[model samples]
Target: MAEANHGKWTYCVDLAREEGRRRTRRRGGFATRAEAAREMKAVLDGELRGVYEDRRTTVASYLREWLAAAKERLAPNTYAGYADCVERDLIPAFGHHRLPDLRPKHIDCWVAAQQDAGRGRVTIYRVVSTLRNALNAAVRSWRLRYNPAKHSVPPKPRAAERTCWTPDEAAAFLRHNAEHYADRLTDLFEVMLGTGMRRGEVLALHWSDVHLMDRKLYVRWTLAAVNNNESLFREPKTEASRAWISLSPRVMAALHRQAALQVAAHPDGRLEGLVFAKPDGLPLRPQWVLDQLRKRTAELGLPKIGLHDLRHTAASIMIAMGIPIAVVSKTLRHTTLAITINLYGHLLKDSADEAVKALAAALDRADAERGASESPLPLAA
Candidate 1:
């Protein structure tokens, strides 16, 4: 060990391989001789345990490498999100630091800076989570001893309240659609609101999957947009999302109308094409759909909502009609019942109140009957 020109301590070690080949490892930038000695000993111990890691890797390099590998495993949309956070956020903030030199304080300061910069809490949370995930991969690969971002991650932001329309509002919106803009989206919105299918699931629906005679449709695929440009047909969001859904009468009618339009447009009967598509049979752009929805809702003087809100509106309607929560969960195809409950619990308040009222009425009637029976026996005596 020796002092460097930069006024920091440096150390070197030599090792022999099983084949008698020799290798040298050097490290520097320790502030004191004692610190250098401690690091050298730790390195030697790591080498003995066969867990040695190169300390020269920088955050930017490792993060990029991790992202490249992640692309193959993650869904296109998910990978796009991760790539955005890594390139636009993580790289700029922590890129210059050596991977091994990163500490919790560095992450803490960066998070503080982000907060001070007026960034949204959700964006900050996602970016920090990306860092933590990348560092976790490094630790698993033996490139990191511990993840500095592990405990420094910000609390997840609360989900925004969903804007849902009531049944009357939904009907009015549909009526407006039929009167002013009777197009493919009219039937699309009808199907979405009637059956509680996700926007992606409905867009990716193929005519072959629809059993109109049986009033059911299979959800096998979902159309995912990557970077708001390219669309890819991926599997359903979850295994439960791929199951068959029973269609309502109105939804079946909408499908029948859509089929008639498609059949009239394509004399060849494009049964294998998407159930909801453009005149050329290509999938409709999600953003374009949102823009149209906004325009129509504004014209009808309804609350501004997105395509996903149609799904929420369906769920709220079902809950209001006294559908069982489990059935609602199945209809929504949530991965877990808890997810359904967490999302729609607020809507169940009326049902809960009604349930307790019925229970109280039953108990009161039983108590009255018992009191009359005891008093009648005394009167007869």
Candidate 2:
């Protein structure tokens, strides 16, 4: 650093470059020489560590580049969400900071602001997760010495209490929908109830995937809304999620009606036409499905639930009707049986009681059989 006659300390550094050219980076107007020296030391340390990306680049620009490069690797829906979080929240918070200047405190402050502003845990969690991932990419690329976002902790998301309608309530709602709003919800809701398929899986269903004779259907792809007023058919969620699901007779009958309706609505359309498309032949957006359910539930004066809640209700119905846990787990296409058990453990509480009772009855029967044999045993034995 060199001081002029005015006596304000100035600092300059030869920043290390990842490429051919060394760049001149400078700062000025520090009140004390020690302050300028400290800044100079930090710059030299960062350069020696080979962790500086340019001090000129903002977090927002770097994050956008990182996300663009990451899009091809991330799932369509997942990438879409990451983009949304960055654009809506992360970029706005740290966008102005130079890449090297983004400290852990900045992230900590952002999280605090989010929580204090009444953001939900899940929302905060997603934003934090997205930021962590972006910064992780930066670390891998040698853009930063470490990820500040690793220390960015949002409030832990509490496991949501599953709120679902009982069998009677479900039946009543279906009856109401079929009677009052037949055109909007009945068949789709029935399919979900029967199969317990996820929202994406159900909406992505195609006529060809349905086997009327076998009373089953194959999950092939998911309908995802990745951008503004647009939707795309992407692959199923995971390897486990792509499987044939058994169909109940009610579900089969609904499919039959749906087929007829599909034919009537879009005759001579694509060969693998969507089973649940808008009237204009476009695939239904996930939001549209949610809005329909929300509106219908409000209209019926019933407890409102999302599409996933319907899946949960279906799981309860299956478990309560004596379907095996493993079977239910496979039917729901959970990655692991443990996940299924954890999510629906409350509904399966009776299973433990039933198991104990069953074991006791078996032992009692065995004892009685042994007593009968003892009485029949003669001295010849």
Candidate 3:
């Protein structure tokens, strides 16, 4: 053990292996030797648990290494997102800080700084999530003693008041499209508003997946934009999402029309591979859908909503019609009922109110029936 004076007695523990193989830890610049000893004690205690890291590793270096290792196993989109968080947000904010020295307060301060820089809670949530996940991997691999980010509270995403078209509004939008802009994409919107399929899921729809005769559709895959403007076809969001869902009558009718359109467009009489393709049989871009919807709705004086809001419209329509939440969960193919509840449970407000009213009405009716029956029995006796 060696003690040096750098404004105070800074100490180094000589955890030397026999035969002069040296393993040492140094901590410094404390007001008291006792303070240094306390930190030294903590480090010694942690060493027993295989929790010691080379104290020289900075947050930036560790995150870069984590990203390099993780990118191989991650999905293209996921890897891209983590890279952005590490390079653009996390490393910039915390690069110089030692990885193992991070604390909950440091993470909290970073979040506040993010807010000051005009990042939303959702964005902050994602960035912090990336940091936490990286550190978690570090801890498991013995690069980090513990994840201080685990104790940190990232900003909670305020569930923005989800604005969506009502059934009436959706019907009007469809009618407007059919009346004025009866294109291939019109059927796309029709299917989305009816089946509650996501924009990517709908865009990736294949004729093979659509069972017109059975009034069902299979959500086999989805499309994603990754690696600049390039697009990739990927699996459904979750295993639960890869499911077969029933089609409504309107959706089935739209499919029949889409088949006719596809057949007439090509010399081959058969409805081809993609149910919704461009005139030249190219896959329609999601940006085209977004732009068209925005443009058309603006012309028609309808409230502006994205393709995703059409999905919310479908769920809202089902909820308004008194469909069971469990059925909605299955239709949407949420990984769990809790996930379904968390996202769309607010829409069930009317259902809850209706349930309470029904219970009260039943009780009242039962009391009246009992009163009448008791008096009649007395008269009969």
lDDT of 3 by residue, 19-63 (tens): 878788676666777766766776776667766665557999999
What residue pairs clash in candidate 2, if any at all? none
User: lDDT per residue, candidate 2, 193-226, as tens digits?
Assistant: 8889988888889888988889889999987777
Tens digits of per-residue lDDT, candidate 1, 285-363, equal 9999999999999998999998999999999999999999999998898999999999999999998999999999999
In model 3, the runs with Cα more than 4 Å from the true position are 1-47, 267-270, 372-381
Query: What do the candidate models score in CA lDDT, each in turn?
Result: 0.89, 0.84, 0.83
RMSD to native, candidate 3: 6.2
In model 1, which regions exceed 4 Å deviation? 1-43, 48-51, 369-381
Please say which candidate is ahead in lDDT: 1 or 2. Answer: 1
Q: Total clashing residue pairs per candidate?
A: 0, 0, 0
The true-versus-predicted C-alpha distance at residue 151 of model 1, in Å, is 1.9
Model 1: per-residue Cα lDDT at residue 229 = 92
